[model samples]
Target: MGARGQGRPVAVIGAGAVGTSVASALARAGRPVTVCGASRRIERIEVTEDGSTETWPVAQATVPDDITGYDTAVLAVKAHQTDAAAAWLKAVSAPGTTVLVAQNGVEQRERVAPHTDGAYVVPAVVYLNAERTAPGRATLRRVGRWDLVLPDEAPARALAAELSAGLMRVGLEADFATVAWAKLLGNITANPLTALTGRRVDVLRDPGIGTVARLITDEAVRVARAEGAALSAAHAREVLAWLENAPEGATTSMLQDRIAGRPLEYDALTGAVVRAAERHGIDVPVNRLILALTSAIHPGQ
Candidate 1:
């Protein structure tokens, strides 16, 4: 079925960088899409990706109630802003709504499930490096395939098929928890460290920062394993290696939020690791320190 069986009505909430990129790509592909929520009244979108820039018209950005019809609502807001998306959820989501949560961390389903009752909550590991230059205008510096982890349901398979045929590549994963936590292990450390340092990910090239990253990730991986994610120390090291070798100026979402003076996602990323570790009787001292530092500095919390 297409967009909850209504056929081709896709609403992408939170017209930030990632949301704008996803909506622009879908609409440009003649997929009948809308870019909405907490954004200016955008008549069109300008996107730059893969050495090419394209502009596409879309339904003007609007509130949730303004969505006359929609089958798929992609929740692309920051994890901490689920409350905002909750209101939008009630506006556009129906019993058959498919809510694709494109956010950081492993708590996508938990964060969004309470709002969109009876909807298919699919957690996606987003791997795109798109930046919002202005409202309704975004630049995709790099693009990576989105991985959707969902139950082997017909709707999920159908949605996966639809998204895969866009400017964005998409794949389906059978073991979502493993994938989510593994992604989180990489996200949790880099975001907080980058936000704290106000620097790009390559700062991990420093031995001191790299050691802190490993120590924190080591504890986080233990908690992930306790929570049945099957993450290992080697996996944590691999994540660190990736960060160390990241492009010189590559920044994380948390770092961008800090730079832009927006509320940081402390609770969702690092805070989630700390809370999970507690449940497993594991210690995450480094993560705790990083969380406290970032929280103390983030004015909007």
Candidate 2:
């Protein structure tokens, strides 16, 4: 709806909640959206919230051959699934293609760009509370907004305008690393803690759990600073408080993975901090413990 790109298509790869909602956003903007899932199990993408449902009848592409022309492909799969996107990336990504990497943590461009050559890859931090119930049905559990934060760049500006035309709010970030790491701090506690205890974000409100959660953020802040992320140690306390006040029924993607018997992204979220801390000679024992404990539960190896 922003600019009719001369017949160039926009594809959302992965049928997960984030990807589904993004496709819905584009569809609501009067864009003909293409959805490429792991399989062709879905015929419709339903986004529901507060007893209201918005359904999009999308063109389904389960394999590379089923996919058509596209200029932008939003990589909405988990970090671990980036490897799985290699085939699809090679098929749809042409010269001048822009792939939006929408996933948790940082280094998204590093993981996704290599699979497709001659494409401008962008990284975006997504804020959403949606979960897939059926193959095509995703429940927008929280009645909030969907948003994307991207570095201030030419392509990112275009993407922001395009998504903002629909049901999304876009923010431009001059210091993208800090914004990304700051969001990562918000994830470290809820992700690992919920996955371990099999509880929702409500666990963070407990006095004892809240203390440990804050400590994890504190350590992650040290790692973020060492990486020149421009995050404040004070923000660590804020992250803990924010989680404590979040919706009681909210759950992280990592927790969803554990509950669904899928692979957890501990390596990308908390484990990322530990790896960065080791490289910078910083001590992050709190992160190390949670990472170790999470790995014990989900050895994704």
User: Which candidate comes out best when scored by lDDT?
Assistant: 2
Give the per-residue lDDT digits (tens) of candidate 2, residues 81-140. Answer: 889878888776777678888899977877877787877888987767778887767876
lDDT of 1 by residue, 1-301 (tens): 3434323768878888888777765665556667775546777778876567888777754556776457787788899888977778777666777777888888887888778877778777776666777887777765223433454556767766666566466666777787778778878878888888878888788888888888888889889998999778888887777667664466788888888889998898888898888898988888898888877985543
Candidate 1: minimum summed lDDT over ten consecutive residues — where? 143-152
lDDT of 1 at 211: 83
TM-score of each: 0.91, 0.93
TM-score of 1: 0.91
TM-score of 2: 0.93
Q: Pairs clashing in candidate 1?
A: none
The TM-score leader among the candidates is 2
